[model samples]
Target: MEERHVIVTYRLDHATIHELCAQLEPDLMSAIRHPTGIPPLLQVLSVLHFLASGSFQTTVAIASGMSQPMFSNVLSRVLSALLKHIRSYIVFPQVGDLPAVKGDFDALGHIPNIIGAIDGTHVALVPPSRSEQVYRNRKSYHSMNVQMVCLADQYISHVNAKFPGSVHDAYILRNSSIPYVMGQLQRHRVWLIGGSLYYSPKKVFQIIVACCMLDNLALCRQVPFLQEDGPAGGLVASVEPLDSEEEEVEEEDIDNGNNVIQQYFQ
Candidate 1:
């Protein structure tokens, strides 16, 4: 295929495509037939095309020179291989390097002690046979409520996607693993910026900020905002004072050199 064709179809250049195929080939080689089946490169290309375009299996199969069933099987195998190897590529920022995370947020909005931003978004999906009504959201559609935490640079630090669409964002956070982790690491004076849905004075110290404009800017710049669709509804601007207990903790941590505004990524 021509370079332009590769780029448009797979959203990757020829060299990068080849490099990815080479890396994935070892895991896929056993599934390929010697002469009758599709080549490994073609399988990778077909799967990439399907993913990039989000087209139906039948449509993608026609372009890939394979039957729909074969294309589906190939896609599943390729996805399985990628999932098996995903851990090597995706990792959260280390606990020791949190100061850098704070610095990045400070540069963006002068928000102090901000280690990350947290938000929940809905992903549209076909209704499941079981408990279909539970998946219907306020907008009258089925979805999965996915929550994510990311740094200022848009790197995701945590994610939880198990909740149904009808579940409230705050409820998801309250039931999530984040609170336990934060409690264990209470020595750090870190906070996350979130919208009204995540606001709770007693649950944790999440900064409630009007993030619609910042979210739009981040999306345009491809800043990896947690939501796959886009920004949630607009939020009214409001700032609540930090609790007295939190203020004391922050002062102690600052005295101990755990300054949340320390220079990061020097």
Candidate 2:
């Protein structure tokens, strides 16, 4: 395949994709090969294409030399394969790691000790017949509420995708392991920020892990995202708050949070 086509379709170059596939191949390889079986490389490639394109299954499936049913299963398979390797890629900063992360972020916004920026998004899904209401988001579509924590360089440091679409972002943040992981004292500090090809809750989470892993790798490789204008631009966009009151932080906490911001700015 031509380099340009591969880059456009997969959003990763051949060498990087090869490196990713190498790590995933052992888990992806079958015990015994069947004539119809997909290779690990093709499995990863097909899934990457679907994620990069965000097109329907049949379209990508057909292009990948598999049926739609096979594509969904393969999507889950390749994504799940990366779950074991996630910590190696998307890691939360420990005390020793905090200074560098804090430095990068502090330079960007002139806020000291801000280790991460957190945000939430909804991953759309086909409404299921069972307990379907929980999956419908405020926008009235089936989805999963996915939370992410990002560093200034755009590496995804953490992810929480266990909640349903109806759940609020702040609720997911409150209920997430981050508070426990970071210690109660650090909860007020550090903060957040993929792809896909699937809708099952388990698969959705895996997709987040896998895509973030690739995104981190791509960031390391200096692979610009489709929308990123050029070298002088950034791997991540600054988070812009929405006008919706639903997105607002608790009124009681705003005063304290503002104080923190003010203290840093001053």
> lDDT at 123 for candidate 2?
79
Q: Write the per-residue lDDT of candidate 1 for residues 1-266, one digit (tens) a residue.
A: 55455555665555665666787788788775443445567667777666555455666766666555566567656665555543444345567877887788899999998877899887555454677888788888766777888778665667676677899998999998788777766678877788612212211111111122223223334432232244542322333222222111122322222111121101
Q: What lDDT score belongs to each candidate, Candidate 1 first?
A: 0.57, 0.69
Candidate 2 scores a C-alpha RMSD against the true structure in Å of 16.4
After TM-score superposition, the amount by which residue 172's alpha carbon in candidate 1 deviates from its true location, in angstroms, is 2.5
lDDT of 2 by residue, 15-109 (tens): 88889889999988852154435567777878888777666766676676665666666776777787878778878778777778888988898
- RMSD in angstroms, all models? 19.1, 16.4
Q: List the residue pairs that clash in candidate 2.
A: 116-191, 117-191, 117-192, 118-191, 118-192, 149-192, 150-192, 150-193
The best candidate by lDDT is 2
- What does the lDDT come to for candidate 2? 0.69
Which residue pairs overlap in candidate 1's backbone? none
User: Stretches of candidate 1 above 4 Å error?
Assistant: 1-7, 33-35, 196-266
Q: How many residue pairs clash in each candidate?
A: 0, 8
